[model samples]
Structure formats: C-alpha cells, structure tokens
Target chain A: MMLPGFPDAAPLAGLGGGILIGLAAALMLLGAGRIAGVSGIASRALGISDSGMSKSSAWMFIIGLPLGAFIVAVWSGGLDAKFAGTGALIAAGLLVGIGTRLGSGCTSGHGVCGVSRLSQRSVVATVTFMAAGIATVAIMNAMGLEVLQ
Target chain B: MIARYLPPLLSGTLFGGGLALGGMTNPARVRGFLDIFGNWDPTLAFVMGGAVIVMAIAWRIQARLAHPLFAPKFALPTRTDLTPKLIGGSALFGIGWGVAGLCPGPAVAALVIEPASAATFVAAMIAGMGIVRLIEKD
Candidate 1:
C-alpha cells in the first residue's frame, strides 16, 4: 500500500522486511545470546573495539549481512538504488561511525531491539535520533539542499 | 566451532534481506522517511512496527529461557544511565543518517547492492570509528 503523500512508499514490503529483521534479531538474541548491533559487531571485527563477543563470531555475523542481501538481490532481481556523492557519503559515514559507537547503538540495536524490550535508554535514544533526523531533514529542505539523488 | 558461527551467519542473512525488502537500503526512501515535514513516508514506521512486535515476543521468550540455544549466557546491555555522551552521539548519528540516509546495517548490505558507494561509506565509517577509539583512549 502507498502512503498518502509518498507515492513510492511500500508499506507491505516494509512490514515484511521488518518482520524478517525482527526474526533475525530474535534469532541472534535467542541463539547467540546477544544483541545484533551491527556497529558493535563491525568495530569488534575490525579490531577497533572489543566487545564481549569474540572477533571470529563478529566476523561471521558481519559476513552474513552482505550475504543475506545478495540472496535477496538474486531472488527479487536486484535494487535500483542511488547513493549520495562521494564527499557526502564520506562525511555521513564518518559521523555514523563515531555517533553509533558513542551512542552505543543505532537503528537495529536501539530502534528494533531496544524498544521491543522496553529498555528506557533505547527508547530515549530512538526518540532522540528520530527527532534529530526530522530536524536535519527539515533544515536541509528549507535550505534547498537535496542530499539524496 | 560451526555452531558458534552459523547462527549469526543465518541471522545476518535474514537481517540483510529484511533491509533490502523494506527499502531501507535505498537512500532516497530513507531520506524520504526522515523528511517528516516534507513529503514524508510512513513506510518506515510500518517496518519498525513489524520488527518491534516480533521482537517483543522474542523478549518474552528470552525472559523464560535459562540461556540462549547456542551460547552459555545472555550477553546483553545492562546499563540504564542517561548520559550526555549518549544524547550527543545519537544526535550526531541522526544528522549523519539524515544527510545520507544510510546506517551501519544498510551500508554494509549495500556493499553488494551498490559496491563503489557502499565501499566508500564503509571505509570512511571505519576511519571515523578509529578516530573515536583514539579519542577515548586519550
């Protein structure tokens, strides 16, 4: 189904995808006894950070992320996506890396896993990010800066 | 050894598939969701809602289990303190996310979907993480 203002929005796909993500996270939590926080895993894998999970385990999970995407691509016939310019991508990436590490989580860790478990910090983090994201978009639009192509 | 790695591999695959199907890997769609005051899309809300509902059930199951299926003990966060660092960092992350509409999960997944762009973002993000690691040590 399409959203009111957004013609390209795919609610069914979003819901289906979300359920898959939830199941994956739940599997991680129940099977591995850990949170599927990508940034934490990535850092640990890269030797930049050391969390409780072993680096090998971290690498295993990290590898799975792209592999999973590949399966979907083959099944669904790939995505037609565009990215920001190199400079913008680099700038944004740097912020995301630092911010997620400092904040202790991101969309999956905080938004999906945290809120579901009713963790106060996760809830607060999720709200803060949402608010900030909205404000940033608003300001950028006002300035007539189209970051996305 | 296989058990140690297999679960996460499967989970990661599922997670990646979800990101792609949900359109989270698409930067424009993500930016559109962030554009709350503009032509906002509620699709992300549905994605979050679906995942949260399933995860809520998982939490309940987690509470009942003695230990995880493949692990000795649950390795989850226990900190509850609200700190300036947390808020400030999250705010920074939000801005970055808004600017590029890509986060760690989608960015990693995008490595295969859109190699060059994803690689660029990943490399920069890792550098940023390295810088933070240095700052924390000092």
Candidate 2:
C-alpha cells in the first residue's frame, strides 16, 4: 500500500533505504567483521561483557547511534528541543532496555540485518516488533495519553 | 575495533542534532509530520532531506578514506534482489511508523533524547521481537 510519509516515494525509497541499510550492515561484517546489529551492541554497552571484543564493539555501536542523531540536530537547526517530562523519558528508557534484553535484538538487528540476511528470526521479529509498535500507539492514542499532541 | 567507531561517532552526533532539528527527537512531532497532506506538516521532509544529504556526504568521505579508520572497506550484500520477507517486513514497518511515528532508528534516537512513549514503544517493540523469535524456533 501507500505510505503516508513520502507518499510519492511508495516502495522505491523505503526499499532503497532498506537496501542501503543492508549494504552498510554487510560491509561492516565483511570489512570490520561486525554485525551492525544495534541491539547486541546497545545491550552490551550496558553490560553482558562475555568477552572484551563483543563488549567494546557493542559500546561503540551504541554510542554511534546517538552521536549520529546529535550531529543531525545541530546541522538542521531547530529552536531548542522539548520533551513530555522526565518521568516518561526515564520510564521509556527502562522499557527499551528491558525489551532489547528479552528480544535479543532491536529493529536494527532484526529489521535491518536479520531481514537483509533473510534470517527467519528477523522476519518474525520484524513483523512482531512493528505490529507491537502500531498497537501501542493506537492504545496510547485512545487512552488519551496523547503524547506529541 | 575502537578505531572503527570513529566514523560512527562523528556521524551519530550529527545524526542526533539533526533529529532534534527535524523534530524526530519527538515522536509526537514526527507523528504530526507524517499526518501531512492530512494537515500539511512539511517539517519531516526537511529532516529527510537533511539526512539524505548527510548520508551522501558520508558516502563520499568513506569512499575516499584509504583506511576507513579501522577497516579496508564496507562489505556489500551478495544478493541483488528481494523476496517475500522484504515485502512483509517493510509493510509491517510502515504501519508501525504511521501509527507510532517512530521507526526503529528514530525510536532509539528518541529514547536517547528522552521520551516516555519511545520507551513504551521500544518495550513493546522488543516484546514483539521476542515473541517472533520464539515462534520462529517452532
């Protein structure tokens, strides 16, 4: 179907973006011998240092994500960013932390790398994760929590 | 390995600030942006444009770097095609993004900037991932 954002793009841009993500992930694996899996990297950053190799790489990867995001904020220019409140952000962070632990990977891991590799796990995880996101938003919207509104 | 992260660090910070500017740091803002045409929020497009531009620059820089800080070069995928998996996963992702206004990357980014919904979204996202993994085993 048609996606709301980039309605003109339809399948082309998303698919193109997906391909690029896959390409980047694959390159990381081949060149640096990394998975480009954000979850593993992020989780390891918090803990789970079975080996220094996995742990260190994970930390860098986790750090890279926000770093990339921060640079984007400044270059684009915006009036100071705002948020719902401290409670929500912290609660959200904890949930995400736990979720990554239980899931074994996040969207980057399963959605990007796992899907790229055609791993069955990625397929299932991606669908489930995405669906959950949809469901959560719907319920939250209905509950009148109305974030961003 | 540590050296390899230098690029990501440089890129990630830029990405973060851009998200803040694009309002991606706010899921509500992103959701509103997606509601464009419905209400005409052209804000997200700028973020998309900005990001695409940054990506273009990174692509060029990476290509020129002889040593890429820690590796020879990026590895690309061998397969040059798509399958049922691509279609299904993308469809699911689209619905999620439409509803929550947070894709995985931005969702994680929002988490960092501190949003309550992002945390819930990520939690549900992980639970969803776990369930999928279990089913796949069977």
Name the candidate that leads on DockQ.
Answer: 1
Residue-pair clashes per candidate: 0, 28
DockQ per model, Cα: 0.86, 0.14
Best by TM-score: 1
For candidate 2, give the DockQ: 0.14
lDDT of 1 by residue, A32-94 (tens): 899988888899999998775888888888898888888888899978687999988999999
Off by more than 4 A, model 1: A3-5
Off by over 4 Å in 2: A1-27, A49-53, A79-82, B1-24, B29-138
lDDT of 2 by residue, A1-149 (tens): 45575443324332333333444454454446444655555444545423223455555545655655555444445323344444444344444444554455555556555554556765666667555555555555567665443
Q: Go through the candidates in order and give each one's C-alpha lDDT.
A: 0.90, 0.50
The docking category that best describes candidate 2 is incorrect
Interface RMSD over true interface Cα atoms for each candidate: 0.9, 7.8
Model 2 score (lDDT): 0.50
